[model samples]
Target: MIQATELRLGNYVNLNDGSEHDKIRQISGIEHKIVYTLIKGCRFAQVHQSFDRIYPIPLTEEIIIKCGFERSEYNDYRHPILFGTLTLYEGVAELHISDMYSVWVNNLHQLQNLYFALTGEELEVKI
Candidate 1:
């Protein structure tokens, strides 16, 4: 199975007006469709059940080194925003990352960095 950690933040291609500014809210099990929430509210959310499409963003080598995977420790939970993704379920939706292999490592690292950068915290996931 493809792991979610292999996906990078940049890998997400927003089908909404061809932008990558949206964040994933949930994923669906039956269809494996990814649900995203826009950083800026859009009227489309009211009319569409799912966005046009979701695509993967590529990861870079520098990101991999910076966002290396480490096992989660109990203390990590104290910082919810840092590791919120691990605990929360995206409601009825499930999160989806592309199955592509070329950018997996780089993407994972970038994703880690993005999370830390945005929340001002680090993530500790099993390597």
Candidate 2:
């Protein structure tokens, strides 16, 4: 479950709807601690969801690639801002800068927050 307070307008998260795979949605709004997601409709409609059905996506190598980072020589995912490595040991994502300053993140939103804090920009992500 994700806290509405921790999410931003553009954060990507998975919304469970009893399907085999959770549906990824970009946050559109938050009110009364309830998250509103943009869903498919004419021009995309907004739907309010409970925290119980909303979850933070686990950070992974594939997700890193999806966010436009390329693989570095060290096999870590690299973008203009930093390089990241996700360990198989519990979906932990470690992002390190050129000076080797590292920050560990458990989900994609946390990574997004960290990136925005450092770069003052939102990630150009598709999902």
- Among these predictions, the greatest TM-score belongs to 2
lDDT of 2 by residue, 29-94 (tens): 888857888885435788788788899999877787787777765546677654444332258867
* Residue lDDT tens for model 1, 1-127: 2234433332333334345564332222212343433333443342122334443333332222233422244211123343332211222111122233112122333455556665766554322
The per-model lDDT (C-alpha) reads 0.33, 0.77
What is the lDDT, from 0 to 100, of the residue 73 in candidate 2? 58
Structural similarity to truth (TM-score) of each candidate: 0.25, 0.84
The numbered model that scores best in lDDT is: 2
TM-score of 1: 0.25
